[model samples]
Target: MAAEQTSSVVLVAVDDTVLAQLVQAATTDALADEVTPPLTAGRAWTADRVAWLREFHRVRRAGLAGPTGEATWAVVVDELIVGSVRLKHTDEHGVLDMGIWLTRGARGRGVGRTATAAALRQAASLGASGVRADTTVTNTGAMAVLRRLGFHLTLSDDGQDVRALLLLDPEGTAACEVTSEPS
Candidate 1:
């Protein structure tokens, strides 16, 4: 599938300085409620700039290594940082794990959908046959988006978290429409 584009959203290479700021913004009380539980470690790092910078370098180093590493991008809208998406190859061949999060202001818009679709397309380019994602059961917004993106529930052990998977077509299409606005 070709890259998807939105008038308001774009996926750009993650900038350590900007990412650090975005992470700090996410920890604010106003935005804290919008952050997913799985991202708690990231929020915590905001309190320690040194640690966050170190992690940033580590992530960058890993990305430079190979497919076994991760590919992360910043979700930008109107030239402002709004969120992030990451795709990491798993132990299983032709399969990757995806993670995404948007700021409070960006939620309920089409930013997440567009950014996620772009990440999935990137995964396909990397030879991934499928992508998996995990989200807390209570994050109904994310779950709904995953469903809309053709991801089917694969596991929901304990009811606290759920895992979903989307299998790419042989032709590499994700088989989902990239609408301009969120449903």
Candidate 2:
């Protein structure tokens, strides 16, 4: 028996609409520790639905926005937001960071690959200099997906966590395309 999957997964721009909430809800609900930020440990926080809602549109509408780019949407089967991904801009040199999550029931259905490809497409279209991602070493699923997307492991502190890096270049021979073509 296979797991039930979301009917569809489409990446759209995040807007001040119901669609934004749908994305946020799915991401939050999928979190193993709503109180702990995925990137870091021991950080106390709560899922601020309203805050995320406001910021999602405010930043998404920026003039620099791109299709499937920063501050966007990934619709999975109508309104059932099976997966969500984002690229947060920061002041640090390599500030473009990505976070993604898929509904528990939506796993093993390619939602992760779909959402990641959408984000990469957006990044490539936006002329991004580079893109970076970090995942726990134990997160084999994430590592596998990243590898499929051409993300190479850049740093690995012992065996606990690994930092994978992917360049979003529009010219280079890097294959940004993600499909289930048997490898």
On a 0 to 100 scale, what is the lDDT of residue 167 in model 2?
Answer: 70
Candidate 2 lDDT at 174 equals 50
lDDT for position 55 in model 1:
62
> lDDT per residue, candidate 1, 84-147, as tens digits?
7778878878888988878777778767777888888777777789999988888788888888
Task: Give the number of the best model, judged by TM-score.
Answer: 1
Model 2, position 97, has a per-residue lDDT of 67
Model 2, stretches more than 4 Å misplaced?
1-8, 19-29, 32-70, 90-95, 180-183
lDDT tens digits, residue span 21-74, model 2: 654565455553431234334332335543554555466655344443356455
Work out the TM-score per prediction: 0.77, 0.68
Q: Give the TM-score of candidate 2.
A: 0.68
Q: RMSD, each candidate, Å?
A: 5.5, 5.3
